[model samples]
Target: MSVDLETVRRVAHLARIKVGDDEAVRLQDELNAILGFVEQLNEVDVDGVAPMTAAVDASLRRRVDEVTDGGNPERVLANAPAADDGFFVVPKVVE
Candidate 1:
């Protein structure tokens, strides 16, 4: 559960980050400290604690799911350089 210098180097390479020997050593110490703290947190008892997404309770407002156009096709295609059959027409790319 502890991070070593080689592990730090591997992680840096995987993350595409360039780290020198000194920086690698420093990151190694920091990662080890973080893992140590997480290990300490695992020692706590949470037998009856409920999982929550946030501290406050709230619900999202929703609208009916229905499909309808903007009620005007000519207006929608008014600014298009080329439109046909109530749709924007683009240059064909393939034969």
Candidate 2:
């Protein structure tokens, strides 16, 4: 795909970017180079490669799921700006 000055101008207009004719020519060259690099990257062979989130081999640490009250309600609500009846109070929104 060839990126021309007209395409650059149209892209700039769609993106709401302010670019003069000289800037558009420069942007055209840059966009063309980027597309060429992407074309080269698309030619790589990865038939059996597995998708990975990170380059390092690390596993996420997980614990067994258990359901219980956090055991310290007063400590958790200590920093609340407004608390009432063991609950954080908020302004009533409905009439």
Candidate 3:
């Protein structure tokens, strides 16, 4: 598909972008060139090629899942503006 000046104007309006006549014409040419490149890409054959996220093989390191109370509450609350009973205190917002 190709883009015309009118199509460029409509796209700009849809995207809430303000494009004057000169800018619209430039955008039209650019969009047409991009679509032409996509058309060329469609001619390539990739019947057996596998989709990949990256060019290199990669894997994530795994860790065992464990749960326990945070060992140090006093250290965690050290920077609180107001703390009580090992918890950060905040002004109540609801009655």
Candidate 4:
């Protein structure tokens, strides 16, 4: 995945960023170096490695699923710009 100056310019344009000709050349070299590093990483043998969400060995703690009151109605409605009873009040859109 070698990147040329023209390809770098096109990428910058697609990203809606301004880049000079010199900067484009520099970015092309940088992108090619990154691709080279990724290629090198692909050569490593990890055939038996298991996919993991976290690097730590600790197991995630979870709680039993149960339904309960979300919060006290008075607390929830406290910051409402306009509230009637326990519900938020909004302008009537339809008659």
Candidate 5:
């Protein structure tokens, strides 16, 4: 999984990034180091380990599903350039 200068140059070209010869060489080394770290991580044993979204388990806070008026319809429509019958009035595009 080692990255070469030519591969780094190609990656830069595909990413639409400007990388000079020296910068490309540096990027090649950096990419190789990152790949090496990922390879090291692949050696770890995780058999039967459950995937987790957070470090600690906790129920997500939620509100009961209920219908309620948001209130302040006039305030919500105040910023509209044109509003009719509590709705935004836009130019008719279809005949």
Candidate 6:
């Protein structure tokens, strides 16, 4: 649960980030603070509470699903650099 400088360095390497020695030390401090906050959160009681998506209660609005031809293939393909037989043309890489 505790983050050290070596762990922070490993995290930076995994994320493809370039962290200097000073930045790594700063990140180690920040990670320790975040872990401390999480530890504080673990002490709270929430036995009977239901999980909620939002504070207010309201049903999410939805639209009916229907299928139709988007109706303009020629218009859609008009800007293509290279198109053939109603499809975008790309160079074949595989034999």
lDDT per residue for candidate 4 within 1-95, as digits (tens), equals: 68878888888999999999888888888999988888886778889997787988898898778876687999999999999989999999899
**Per-residue error (Å), model 4, residue 89:** 32
Summarize candidate 1's per-residue lDDT along 2-92 as a digit string, tens digits.
Answer: 9889999999999999999999999998999889888987788988998788777878768788866688999999999999999999999
- lDDT by residue (10-94, candidate 5, tens digit) is 8899999999988888888889888998898778788998778888788888988996768888989999999988998899989
Instruction: Tell me the tens digit of each residue's lDDT in model 2 across 59-92.
Output: 8888779865687889989999999879999999
The digit string of per-residue lDDT tens for model 6 on 1-95 reads 88989999999999999999999999999999989878987777989988888888888888778865587889889999999889988999789
Residue pairs with clashing backbones, model 5: none
By summed lDDT, the worst window of 10 consecutive residues in model 2 runs over: 60-69
Per residue, candidate 3 scores C-alpha lDDT tens digits across 1-95 of 99878889998999999999899988899999889988987777988988778777778777778765578989999999999998899999789
TM-score of candidate 1 to 2 decimals: 0.47
Clashes of each: 0, 0, 0, 0, 0, 0
**CA lDDT scores, all candidates in order:** 0.90, 0.88, 0.88, 0.88, 0.87, 0.90
Candidate 5 yields a Cα-based lDDT of: 0.87
Runs of candidate 2 with Cα error greater than 4 angstroms are 44-95
RMSD of each: 9.8, 10.0, 10.1, 9.2, 8.8, 6.7
Give model 4's TM-score versus the native structure: 0.44
> Alpha carbon lDDT of residue 88, candidate 1?
98
Give all TM-scores, in the order shown.
0.47, 0.45, 0.45, 0.44, 0.45, 0.49
* Regions of model 6 farther than 4 Å from truth: 10-17, 66-95
